[model samples]
Each structure stands twice: as C-alpha cells, then as structure tokens.
Target: DQQVKQNSPSLSVQEGRISILNCDYTNSMFDYFLWYKKYPAEGPTFLISISSIKDKNEDGRFTVFLNKSAKHLSLHIVPSQPGDSAVYFCAASLRGGADGLTFGKGTHLIIQP
Candidate 1:
C-alpha cells in the first residue's frame, strides 16, 4: 500500500487565485513531509517542506501545513499563476532513511486564465 496519498487527481484555479492541494498519509513514523512540482518529461523539483514538530512552513507564495494527529498535510499557493501549472507530488520520509522518499501519485494543478 502507498504510505502517502493525494486524494484529488487534479485541480483548476484562475490565474490570479489561490490553489489548494491536499495529501494524506497512513504512516505515523514519517517525520518529514515535502511537496514537489514536476513538469512533463522532467524530474520533480522541491517546493516546500514541513517537519512533524511544526504545524506550518511557508516560503514566498507557497505554504505547507501538517497535522500529525490526523496524519494529513496540505499545500497552498497564493496568486496562482499559469506557470505554476504542474504535477504536484507529496512525499514523506523519516529523519534518516536509506529507503528514500515515499511519494503520492500527484495532483495536476491547472491555472486557467
């Protein structure tokens, strides 16, 4: 079974609106969570991350929130632009891991004009 999950397969938002993406996890041992954006025919690039100890982490127009109790997390994008359109993946990992990251299938975010 997949430890990380992105329930919504896709989302659409206006060019200047806010876009919200959600993710859920079944593993309690995960201590770190990250969000990545991937363009077609390219590898994923890191967006933002949050540790289990913190409830929120923000950078620029992006924000990530974690809820350890519910084993859920979310990513928010403000003033979403068409350039932000991409496949967003949620990944979870332990503090130190040789197994690498467990990633969700991803959600395709489209910015409509």
Candidate 2:
C-alpha cells in the first residue's frame, strides 16, 4: 500500500503562471504534513509544513492546503519561475510522534521561461 503518492511524476508551466502539485495519502495516523523541494542529485529541503489541526499554510511564493476529511493535500506556487523548476515531495509523519516520514515519489515541476 502506498502511504503517500503523487500521481503525476511531472508538471510543466510558464514562468509567470501558477503551478500546482497534488498528493494523496491513505494513512489515518499521519498528522504532520510537509513539502520538500529538491534540485538534481540533492537532498530535499524543507519548504512548508502544516499540522492536522490547521487547513492551510503559506510562505512567500508557496502555499499548502490540507483537507483532512479527504486525506489529500496540494501545493501551489504563484507565478512559477524558472527557479521553481525542481522536484517536490510530499511527506507525512505520525501524529505527535518521531519516526521519520513517508515520502511520495515526487513531482518534477518544470518552469518554462
């Protein structure tokens, strides 16, 4: 069973357009959600995170929304830029626990200038 999944392996958008990435999870115990962006051959860096108690979180050009009832979450980047072209991975952790995280395969967002 896939604890976390990103159905789309890639996404492309113009430099000044909106870019959206989707992720799904099946584990009911996952309460902490995080999004990581990575460059080629590099480890993923933390971008944004949201707890199960909250529905939305934002930072600069990125926003994450969680729908606990639906077990889905998405990341949105406004005015996508060439710099935003990277792999985004969605991860989840057990609520209020410390056992690392489960990661999605990742979505490669390509920004066209």
Candidate 3:
C-alpha cells in the first residue's frame, strides 16, 4: 500500500496566482516532510522542507505546511509563473531524514497564462 498519496493527479493555476498542492500520509512515523519539483528530462530537486515540530516553513515564493495530527501537508507557491510549472512530489522521511524518503506519486502543476 502507498503510505503517501496525492489525491489530485494534477492542478492548474493562473499565472501570478497562488498554487496549492496537497499531500496526505498514512504513516505516523514520518517526521520530516519535503517538497520536490521536477521538470521534464530532469531529476527531482528539493524545493522546501518542514520538520514535524514546526507547522510551517517558508522560502521565498515557496512554503510548506505540516499538520501532524491530520498527517497532511501542503506546498504553496505564490505568484505562480511559467517556470513554476512542473511535477511536484511530496516526500516524507523518518528520523529527521536519516532514513530514505517515501514519495507520493506527484502532482503536475500547470501554470497558465
């Protein structure tokens, strides 16, 4: 069974708008949450990360929020641009990322003009 799941296969957002990507996890052992963005013909690159102790973490136009009680997390991209269009993968790791991450199927984000 997949421990991590992205309910929406894809999302579309207007340029300069905010794009929110949701992810849910069934595993409570997860303590670290990471968001990765991938473009075609390229490997996934780390975007942002949040620890279980913190509810939110922000980096420039990217932000990650974690809800431990609900076992859910979300990535927010403000002012979405064409360059932001990519596949976003939500990953979780145990022991503060000492172990390997469990990645969700990923959600394709399309930024439209």
Tens-digit lDDT string for candidate 1 (1-113): 98999999999999999999999999999998999999999999999988888999999999999989999999999989999999999999997333589999999999999
Candidates in order have lDDT scores of 0.95, 0.94, 0.95
Candidate 3 local lDDT, residue 62? 96
Q: What is the TM-score (0 to 1) of candidate 1?
A: 0.96
lDDT of 3 by residue, 15-70 (tens): 99999999999999899999999999999999999999999999999999888999
Report residue 89 deviation for candidate 2 (angstroms): 0.3
Prediction 2 TM-score vs. true: 0.96
TM-score of each: 0.96, 0.96, 0.98
Question: Which structure is stronger by lDDT: 2 or 3?
Answer: 3
Summing lDDT over every window of 10 consecutive residues in candidate 1, give the lowest-scoring window: 91-100
**Model number with the top lDDT:** 3
Error of 3 at 32 (Å): 0.4
